[model samples]
Target: MSTTTSNHIGRKISRIRELRGMKQETLAEAMGISQQSISQIEQSETVEDEKLEKVAEALGVTKEGIKNFSEEAVFNIIGNTVTNNDNAAFFNNYPTFNPLEKLMEAVEENKKLYERLLKAEQEKNTYLEKLLSK
Candidate 1:
């Protein structure tokens, strides 16, 4: 740990965005902001609570997750999981369950949501067609 306390919220956001495989432009679109604005936010040391909440939502992470972000913890989790190292170097980084399982769950949930959306669109088209015929 560094002697200086590091509580840079912007860095955390940027790191999480990168790890999520999201482009700055993608995040900007999600937040309804410009890519330049996203760049500015990343440079900021502190962001307002409301903005932070929006950013967290756009990143698909909780506000607390952004607040508590740590590169070391992330590294520990990845290293341990891949190497099957039983050593728990960090308490917070300790996996409560399988990460891969959670990822699969997220994928399945997204698939269901897409199906629901597609169905809704099809129903909407049918309704519009009936109105046109009348």
Candidate 2:
């Protein structure tokens, strides 16, 4: 829709392909397209819906998959090691949450539960010692 929004998606697509250790030519061949087309896509703000679909399918991702990515995700993953305040400026400008967020939330919840269990066990052990001394 907006120039910034399209650029965000383009960046995401490029980033994912790179993370997968795939070259533009590799992705292009898998999608039955030319390397120039892949290069244009990675550099362009927008691509056709049909081509987008093909790219996603070839990459084993979803159509909405490439479009809804965020740089914050990668940052959150690597402990916020490297960040750009502007990296995600155009992301929420076009809002969408990928599954990774949900997975992270679940992991946090599990950690909390584990912590509570440990604390409860310590309390129980203290109570038992006090009772035995009585």
Candidate 3:
């Protein structure tokens, strides 16, 4: 079992399962494995080749498709083209962003701004109506 892309593979599996709208229980049953096993596999730090093949079959995808499946692969593939210093610059420019935190903040800010704008629009409309009536 190689640990190189265990997390990556697990994420890919989860994404594929979600895309197919298949529950973890369903996938576990189809693969003849326990639900816990499926969960562990999806969260595993390293996965066996046989297990990978089984997962690919169950997902109706190729092993390479699962193994090579990620935007991170783009970084990994371009690794040789970057030096230590160059890579440091890249990471500095685009530090890893947490999805949940960033999204939550954006949503809250958008809600506040949207409410403010709507209120202002309502006030403007009321003032315009009064002026036009007069």
Candidate 4:
């Protein structure tokens, strides 16, 4: 029998996150962790139970869901659901997209961008002042 690294918990989590259309930064923020920490966790082979619990919550999935996640199954479900004519029934759990959440994400990104731009401008002004003094 061949050994299968396919059961790696980190890989499962990473794949599930991708399936949920979530970025590492988003998950990191939800988990109250640094993005680098999320990246590190994704690269790990195994995570502690407490950390895994936090990750599952951040990902909006149960721990069992993460553990049992299957890409093929996800694709198959999507494929089957999309073929149906009733769009409403296809999404019985929750809507695939949430406009309010998307709007908030956009707002947060814009705020961050503006903050960075402001910082750059401040640095430029400081440099100009130093040059004038010289």
Better of 2 and 3 by TM-score: 2
lDDT of each: 0.88, 0.79, 0.81, 0.85
Write down the TM-score of every candidate.
Answer: 0.58, 0.51, 0.47, 0.57
lDDT by residue (19-102, candidate 2, tens digit) is 779999899999888999888888877778988898888778897878876656665676565365556633446437767888
Model 2 spans > 4 angstroms off: 1-7, 78-134
Ranking by TM-score: 1, 4, 2, 3
lDDT, candidate 1, 36-134, per-residue tens: 999999888899999999999999999989998888888777886764355444344768899999999999999999999999999999999999999
lDDT of 3 by residue, 6-118 (tens): 45778778777776799999999999999999899888755789999999999898988877776456456678667785567556565488889999999999999999999
Which of 1 and 3 is the better model by lDDT?
1
Ranking by lDDT: 1, 4, 3, 2
Model 4 score (lDDT): 0.85
TM-score for predicted model 3 compared with the true structure: 0.47
Once model 4 is optimally superposed onto the true structure by TM-score, how far is the C-alpha of residue 133 displaced, in angstroms?
A: 70
The Cα RMSD of model 4 versus the native structure comes to 15.2
TM-score of 4: 0.57
TM-score of 1: 0.58
Clashes of 2: 0
